[model samples]
Target: MATTNIWQKFKALIPEGSRTIVTITANNGNGTSQAQLRDGSVVTVKGESVQAGLKAFVQGGEIKGTALDLAQYEVEV
Candidate 1:
């Protein structure tokens, strides 16, 4: 499914008129990808990914435990 569509569906699951803070983090293994959306809870996604802008990546591969800084990401609602 498209990312917008996924977020639209997920929006219904959250309470109305509220804001949610989430971190979209990706951890890739050889030949595959996995991601986590942390909003005080972790929702893992397989075979899908999050997009980060240039310079958003902090460090990777066990260097800093995150690919992007907290300010570089956006959660669509």
Candidate 2:
């Protein structure tokens, strides 16, 4: 007899922290900065190296790296 580990299987499909594209809204002058998401909500991210008015990839509340300044579009289903 074998046990069906459904929980583990589902967990494996989920990522620890999905990366997101955000624009640097403001710099706190510290090691952290504020970023605005696609939904227009702002959140603090770890990293001030990237100046404002630029885009970056954030993951787990930290700045993973810089992202290309590309325009985004939304479509209706």
Candidate 3:
């Protein structure tokens, strides 16, 4: 006899919210601002008033807080 498992029926799950560091490009006003990712993608995130040309952490379409202005290094594998 063969046994069936229910867990195998589920596909690999991925988290909906992921945090990323971005630079504030512009302020949209009303407690929102536009940010640019490291790959040069611009996205609008909601959070406290932040000045443009600053780095901040964004998650779930919202800005969690500011991030350090450290140098970025990329590695190829």
Candidate 2 displacement at residue 34 in angstroms = 0.7
**Per lDDT, what order, best first?**
2, 3, 1
With a 3 Å backbone cut-off (N, CA, C), the pairs that clash in candidate 2 are: none
Give a tens-digit lDDT track for model 2, residues 1-77.
99999999999999788899999999998899999998999999998878899999998999888899976798999
- Measured by lDDT, the strongest candidate is 2
1 or 3, greater by TM-score: 3
Q: In model 1, which regions exceed 4 Å deviation?
A: 1-22, 30-38, 52-77
- For residues 1-77, what per-residue lDDT tens digits would candidate 1 score against the true structure? 63467887888887544332334445455422333334344443332233422111112311222343545567899
lDDT of 3 by residue, 1-77 (tens): 98877666553364457889999999887788989998898888898556798899888989888898998698999
- Evaluate all candidate structures by whole-model CA lDDT and list the values in order: 0.37, 0.92, 0.83
Residue pairs with backbone atoms closer than 3 Å in model 1 (clashes) = none
RMSD (Å) per prediction: 12.9, 3.1, 5.0
Better model by TM-score, 2 or 3? 2
User: How many clashing pairs per prediction, in order?
Assistant: 0, 0, 0
The C-alpha local distance difference test score for the whole of candidate 1 amounts to 0.37
